[model samples]
Target: MLGKLKDLLFSASEADARAADHDDVAVAAAAVMVETATLDGTFDEDERASILGLLQRRFQLSDADARELLAEAEAEQQDTNELYAFTRAIKDHFDHDQRVEMVEMLWEVVYADGVAHDFETNLMRRVCGLLYVEDAESGAARKRVLDRLGLSS
Candidate 1:
């Protein structure tokens, strides 16, 4: 798992290097969102829509582009059972504010179905830990998301 992540995150191979130049940030963000949406036993329509909307708004992509990114992210998420590499990549690529925004995006996905399952919460904790986002910052991000969505925490 670590090896695979290292390669994906840091490899200088031609293909990966090209991909890294293209939109590593988008791929990494989409991958994390995909993982969150699927962490629970099911990936319902609500979760799917939530992720699509988040992707569109965060990345400023058109519906078609966002859908494409979502599809790519889903495929990548399925290939890995561990998120350490993705989170690590995100940590290395994103600044502190961007990481906090990611946490907010995650919270949005978690509450999209009108519920936050244990597995989903656990995944958020792990992702934040790997990103080196402080607990207080993550908690604040969650709260902001919940309040914006009018959901109680």
Candidate 2:
């Protein structure tokens, strides 16, 4: 029936739109993570590996997919000096708890090299503000990450 065909087509397009939205969110998150890892003027293997693992865990991506995402995100991040676009995508897509988790993820990337530089810390503060995550919550997330990594906060 024409009606049935229309429904099928509409549903397929709707699903495609959702998939695209999901991909946008994923790329935005990965780009922010890449920035976090590289903000300290160094992009070492440990930071790359940490971002790869975090991307895998956060988005449930396979190794190959995560690597591809990392590459795409790095390119995207390099192309833009503004964090607003990436943060806007994240803020629009993620709920408050997820945003907090994002802050935690940034914290993880910051400590990937077993040290947190001033620039990285400043970046986190600005990101948290943009994401509307409160300072107390961001501090708590940082503490949790530090505790997990056996580091003193």
Candidate 3:
């Protein structure tokens, strides 16, 4: 019985590792979003909470899980050379409208602090391009986010 229990524990650990590997893309995307939200060197509490909330809602994750993913994402973002690694996974896994929604969500993060910085705007543009969202669609997404946030475009 002890041997069986040990085997079960080992299997569970392996499964957990595989699950983490599978979630790497989501973690990377979360990291990019967090990075963009903090582009101005000010990661306000509200903005951080908003990002955590979004991740929880979108990924169906618990607060702890979301935080863990965010931590992994933050580490990945630190060394990332381009947005392709994250965006490609999103493009492959999410539908077009979902991708568009992601763009809007990024815009929301940009606007969450009541101001959009140049770094944030440029990062959004680059991210949209990497996600294969057309310029027109990206603009529309921005507009949608502005409307949702009751901010002027």
1-153 per-residue lDDT for model 3 (tens digits): 999999999999999987775586577668778878778998887787778888888888999998888778777877775677788877776678888878887887898887899999999888888888888998998888888889887
Candidate 3, backbone clash total: 0
Q: What residue pairs clash in candidate 1, if any at all? A: none
Give, for candidate 3, the lowest lDDT window spanning 10 residues: 20-29
lDDT at 79 for candidate 3?
Answer: 77
Clashes of each: 0, 0, 0
Residues 1-153 of candidate 2 have per-residue lDDT tens digits of 999999999999999999999999999999999899888889999999999999999999999999999999999999997899999999999999999999999999999999999999999999999999999999999999999889887
Clashing pairs in 3: none
Error of 3 at 79 (Å): 3.3
Best of the candidates, TM-score: 2
Model 3 has an lDDT value of 0.83
TM-score of each model, in listed order: 0.84, 0.97, 0.80
